[model samples]
Target: MQEPTLLILTALADEPRHGYGLIQEIEAISAGRYRMRTGTLYGALDRLLSQQLIAVEREEVVDGRARRFYTLTGQGRAALAAEAERLRSVAAEAERRLHVLRPGLQGGAA
Candidate 1:
């Protein structure tokens, strides 16, 4: 999965969120490195919804406006778990290779 998709799934894994809430959470998750635009976020959300990876958990009325909250489906959780494991495995392999290449490297750093 793409980083944005992975980040979205990871964010929703904790709790359902509305669009603005999702944007805020994702920014926090990326440590402000990622600032998602409204159109991009909605596009990703639409794709995920159509793929059945995420579902509308609920809708709320905030200031007389409806806000949809999205949550990860069972399949989404499984996919996220798999992706996280894959990332960990790749990182470990990269570290191993780095150590082999640089004998004096300490814990994956020169």
Candidate 2:
């Protein structure tokens, strides 16, 4: 999966969030490394909805504007879990190789 897609799924992992809320949560999750534009976010939301990875949890009007809250589907949760495991495996192998290359190195010290 793409980094943005992964980040989006992760942001939705804990709880439902509206578009703006997802944006804020994704920024926090990436430690400010990524800031999704509104257009990009909505586009991704549309794609995810079509893929059944996420669904609109609810919709309501606030201050005369309609806001949609999104939640992850079971398929999305499973996909996220699998991707996390794959990342962990890759990281572990990299760490092991690093240790072999530098016996005294610890914790990614350069």
Per-residue error (Å), model 1, residue 30: 0.7
Q: How close to the true structure is residue 96 of candidate 1, measured as C-alpha lDDT? A: 92
The total number of steric clashes, by the backbone 3 Å criterion, in model 2 comes to 0
lDDT of 2 by residue, 15-95 (tens): 999999999999999999999999999999999999999999999988898899999999999999999999999999999
Candidate 2 lDDT (Cα, 0 to 1): 0.93
- Candidate 1: which stretches are off by over 4 Å? 101-110
Off by over 4 Å in 2: 102-110
* Candidate 1 least-lDDT 10 residues: 101-110
TM-score of decoy 2: 0.88
Q: Each candidate: what lDDT?
A: 0.92, 0.93
- For every model shown, the clashing-pair count is 0, 0
Using all chains and alpha carbons, the TM-scores for the candidates as numbered come to 0.87, 0.88
